[model samples]
Target: MSAESLERQTRSYLSNNVPQIQEHGGFFEIQDVDDESGEVTVAIGGACSGCGIAPMTMNAIKHRLPDDLDDVSKVNVTRAGGPRAAVMPTKTEEMEEMEEYKDYSPPF
Candidate 1:
């Protein structure tokens, strides 16, 4: 899918699911997603940061989001601070940067 649509759907999925995590005393805010790889890097903050159950939660996210969002094939949870709105990427600028150089080759 195009990066724009991917970002929109991803944000929607996360918006739907984040509250569930919040109820468990933790949070999952998307830091980045490599659309080409379906790899999602999320910052696990709040009480989940040092919680022993963080892995379990991470596992749940990895297993669950993909089932919910078609584009989600993988999930990588992490620790971060601040608010969720501030943490989530409104667009896939991270992926677009790589595309800018996709045709690059040495002139030599």
Candidate 2:
């Protein structure tokens, strides 16, 4: 298959099979496709940053993409953001206080 067709097929498969990715504000980008080697590189981004389930998603992609698509021998899936992106920002004191109040139950 041509690189363009392969990319298109990859996108379609991900969208149909992995609808949760989009529901969670995540997306997959096809970075490159080697026609000769039948290898494809994909970058996962958006809310996938720092997401605990991303590793599982990556593994799924690596194993499933090749099986689903013709001429795809190997799949390389990587997070778009680096290590720093995995660290969620700390909440401020005000935000913590708000949560404390929000969770409080008043007695009648």
Candidate 3:
């Protein structure tokens, strides 16, 4: 299969099978495709850069791509940005939680 075809197949598979990536504001980029060896390198970018679930996403791509696509023999996924510091809860989030129990009555 041609490189172009392999890329298209990969994109289609990711979009359909891995909806979480797109839903979480992340996307996969086709870095390299070797038609001879059937190896495809993909990069996860956007919100997935420092995402906690990035590892799981990479694993899914690595294992599922080959099984799903006939032309793809191997998949290598990499994240764009490395690890990031944890984000603190925003005021809005805190307020939303407070509002949920604002009307609660104590049983005591």
Per-residue C-alpha lDDT of model 2 across residues 1-108, encoded as one tens digit per residue:
778887888888888888777788777778888888899998877776656556567767787789877789999987666542344334322332354444432221
Candidate 3 lDDT over residue span 3-70, tens digit each: 89988889888888887778877777788999899999998877765565555567667877898788
TM-score of each: 0.56, 0.72, 0.71
On the 0 to 100 scale, the lDDT of residue 18 in model 2 is 81
66 Cα displacement, candidate 2 (Å): 0.8
Best by TM-score: 2
**C-alpha lDDT of all candidate models, in order:** 0.60, 0.70, 0.71
Q: Between 1 and 3, whose lDDT is larger?
A: 3
- Cα deviation at 24, candidate 2, in Å, is 0.5
Model 1 spans with C-alpha error above 4 angstroms:
81-108
Error of 3 at 69 (Å): 1.0
Q: Would you list the rank order by TM-score, best first?
A: 2, 3, 1
RMSD to the native, candidate 1?
14.0
Tens digit of per-residue lDDT, candidate 1, span 1-108: 765666677767766765655775666666787889777777777666555444455555666778888787887765577653223342322422455433433121
**Which one wins by TM-score: 1 or 3?**
3
Q: In candidate 3, list every pair of residues with a backbone clash.
A: none
